[model samples]
Target: MSGHRAYTPSLRDRLTKAVMTAAGYLPGPLLRPVAGAPRRVDGQVLDPHFQAGLRVISLMSEGEYQDLTLERARSVVERSAYTVSGRKIDLAVVTDIVLPLGGADPDRADLPARLYSPVDGDEALPVLVYFHGGGWVLGSIDSHDATCRYIADTGRLKVISVDYRMAPEFLFPTAAEDALAAFRYVRDHAAELGVDPQRIAVGGDSAGGNLAAVVCQQTRDAGEKTPDFQLLFVPATNMSARTRSYELFGDGYFLTRGNMDWYERTYIRSDDDRLDPRASPLLATDFSGLPPAHVATGGFDPLRDEGEAYARRMADAGVKVSLRRHPTLVHPFVNAVGATPLAKAALSEAVGAMRMALAY
Candidate 1:
């Protein structure tokens, strides 16, 4: 738990990284004519680097998630995580552990988790209980290892990345219930984990973000202690309906409309389940007492409109919320922190907000 090591990339991974890094440096003028004039939708032009990257991805991709079998889709995500997550950050402590699910179900399997702590920090630090994205049907602690390491090292805080149960196997409410359980366990055991119970934060991207928002609402409605802050990146706030962003950017973006439909079908029981507040936090009755939040959205992402709408809803309900729209980015920017400087900077900004919010 008190050492650091670098992740050795495979030959294919290294080659892929090299190609992407090179593409990032290409002049915009050279890329524009080929990738099509800088796409301007919703008043935001797509980042030239990302446009080039997307072109590369499209050329290299085997198939979209909607077209791949579930197992193949999951494998593709795992490989992509390693390829684009960059090198792992060095931290003072990194350890794998199991979280006991001790709530209503005593017989449930313990969740796999990883804890990351920076070298420079006090004995007790603010902690972010993070969840990985993949429409709740993919991703794992391994997939988000670099992300947690980056947050822990750069933010000078502790991070516990939860490996929640996924879908097509563990249906609706399972992931949501597990997320709540993980947060509760961390809060209740903060002392043992050497984290500040008073400053615990909940965060995640995509489906994971949905869980974080739901956790806040669930705690509020149940009259329990809530997270000190919430960080949501490209969150699917409302799953019941598609928004204008979906209509605009859903086709060519990394997260396509068909992919989202597949995820929903794999994760939920029926159309009615999509309307449940647990599945769609925006449909919740109240957002007034939820913790302060930073909702970051990519202008080109299908989830952009809903994410912004969620932030607005929270603010209107009297919750303090910060909505950051990265005009030139896409859905997976958070995962690409190591692959590109811009993505790294974007994550740094969000982590900076988390640090400031928990500084007290």
Candidate 2:
């Protein structure tokens, strides 16, 4: 009863914070209190929040990059949250093929994308360019297998899930560039790629959702063909540090404010970097002439307020906007698979939205 409230996140959130709090504070160098480091960690994984705090302090102390390294955080986060155990790639549509997009590093650079079809590669189908969520830090096409497959199989469309560049190493604009490059690649070879040029749409959840909106906005501005519709699932639309949601749910919902700080620091360079419209779309002055869009917000996400605000602003700017607020789920809950009922419902609604986008 103490956790119950007529608001997003609900008891689930209070419990997480309670747990984090129960863990007892560690010095600024042993965050999370893990048993031991993994045998072969490719990046830093904190056992304690303060350990992360220590790293930040040390970075500042050593005059190093005091900012967060999403790349480093992701190494630990994937182990806890984003790691997938079951099927990594499930293509329910026509037939699924995982193709390698051209990347500089064959082992690392060549982006891995999945092609989901409603039918054989012979027919043209409406296409969806999907980017998955992980705060641009973690998550891969494999982590979001079910959702993308559901979209292609149930929505009766072709889907392309992009494995965009993430943070720390290829920071901001790189992922954005990858998103655009993937779209352009799909557009340039629509016929050969088995897509209908006019029926293409862009979509993703959380960070991916942000990329989706950015893709559309950039397309319109660059005089490129716009996706028929845009689907944003609990998008992290505005990185501005001033949103009310940031103050409200910043410390809980399994996505702590510290975590966000970690993610954003990895994504952008400085406060001045926030000025880059590419970093925060809400910072953009003109939302006019962008494609019709649907922006979904998690009532509990720190990014929720900005997501809805962006949608309303879009509507006000004359872009066809459909906004839905799921006041019961937490950020990235859509990727929680079937664990949470609300997540299931959100997933269904997301597929339905994508179907609508293709229908139009």
Candidate 3:
């Protein structure tokens, strides 16, 4: 028997890619009317709205963003985000700011961050320190703008989206380092941000979710005030993609194992980096005394098992854990909230948990 190889698209896959590519050159008016229907990939039935979004994505490119240079991939993601996520909003008093990178680097400048507050509130609000996910390689505050807005509006809490430094520019520990620095910055400056320092929570989807989990563990270890709660949406909890979910759902879904491998390889400086507890929170020895956690996973996501596994570990280690697995959905469903009822409902459920946990 042979070991697994990178996925090779079938003839149909090739044709689909070609057709979608051709459609991309059509005028905006011609393309605007197209819609995608619910279709099964392998055995899983993708959500109709999510399927429609995938059509839009298909028109943009073939294969994974992993194949492109960091710059080109980022441009594609940005354009797709704007097309799928709609325009950035002025609601919630959104502002851009710089947060110090902390930790004894005289030359290290502050990180870029964005703050989103609910419209017109006199009292201090609970805040969710958010990180955008792109395998720790491709996302930014702008890429995840719409999702942040949805979270802020639905959860009725302030949201601070952090633009942590990424890989091929800055690797593993840098992103994690920036996350901790941003968390500390917000906690220390809560008064100025009009947020209740004590009520500030941390959350993110996919790669960002991994950072959130790591930030929680780092806080616990440092004897610092822990986040009020954690909102993880399809977080990649472990760098080692050996889990069964990865094997079962790695190829056909939106997130492929090959792309995942590309992400891990790009973000990690050395093979040993995979075992670092900060990079892979599931490898952490202790989970006790961490804040309450709500972990959401997609049944068809390559990263699903690790997220659920981490939740199980948290539960066993006496931490409060809430795990929601959307059996029919794929990764990145949270971003589909604007188009899919299922995605919106799932996000709403997670945010409601945050609201209850934070008591705001």
Candidate 4:
């Protein structure tokens, strides 16, 4: 990565960032009373700062994703990323490249990807093919740019953020196919991409995380090479059924049950699709021989239970796996890293694990 110009925040983005930063400094005693009684569930208490932040977020929200039209939902998510994503960290190299979609019709557009490296050089570095999470319908490379920059800079590795096609327009298997295609392209062309062929990893957040897990399982079943590691952040592992977390935290948290229902309805063609391993990796019967994995979940997130369950299942099948629950965190914590100290710490911890896993 070569030195690049820093990102300039819009006035509103700066204000939102300022408010979130200031909230982090407020005493828990002060926030708890203001945000209401401390919320404790599943033996984890919500962080007071996040409790206050969510209160403010709810006050400002016009509507949840379920209430908005497709175009409006997409626009809101894109804009929301800037408000919470923190300032983009400067990297040595950040460039955009097109990835050819494997097995797609000639007329279909190629995947758009952004490659991020912390240091500029010809060194063949370990690389992570990252997918942006938006419930399989809402995010983009640009939306996740700041997080990728943070991971590349902090983890001291290269990150290629894949802008896989989204739902309603593309649907479930399409995103999974694109994820597999992107990982294969990186592995096969590692030298050209300035990455080590033997050290490639696949990762993503939320829906993207689901895709990463699917890619690992898909490759293993097909007798193809799998990535060296998998990095999942607040991943939704099972779509077939809602877990206890959904009943506990789904409504009030940023990711609501209604919103999840909308995402699933839009991304999946039918109920049967939810049971497909590619759509719901947890439903897969075999987890043996999958690559080592790091699955991080928010204690308050609806997807937390499933993500942890997936990790445990993988471990039971003899795959080396680690699961870290950020007790006070919520879903989409990665986007808050720039403004939230705890969130930033959590991401750094996960990225640290990634670095160690891929270290030469």
Winner by TM-score between candidate 4 and candidate 3 = 4
lDDT of 2 at 243: 82
The TM-score-based order of candidates, best leading, equals 4, 1, 3, 2
**Candidates 2 and 4 compared by TM-score, better number:** 4
| 135-171: candidate 4 lDDT, tens digit per residue | 9888788778888998888888899998888888787
Q: Could you list the CA RMSD of all candidates, in the order they appear?
A: 3.5, 12.4, 7.9, 3.6
lDDT of 1 by residue, 164-203 (tens): 8888878888899889989999999999889998999999
Please, what is the whole-model Cα lDDT of each candidate in the order they appear? Answer: 0.85, 0.66, 0.78, 0.85
Give per-residue CA lDDT, model 3, range 267-312, as digits (tens): 9999889999888899998889999999999978988889999999
Task: Tell me which residue pairs clash in candidate 4.
Answer: 1-92, 1-93, 1-119, 1-120, 2-92, 2-93
Name model 3 segments beyond 4 Å from true: 1-44, 86-90, 102-104
Per residue, candidate 2 scores C-alpha lDDT tens digits across 87-143 of 233453433343445657532344567788757647787888998887777767756
What TM-score quantifies how close candidate 2 is to the native fold? 0.73
Please identify model 2 stretches exceeding 4 Å from their true place: 1-109
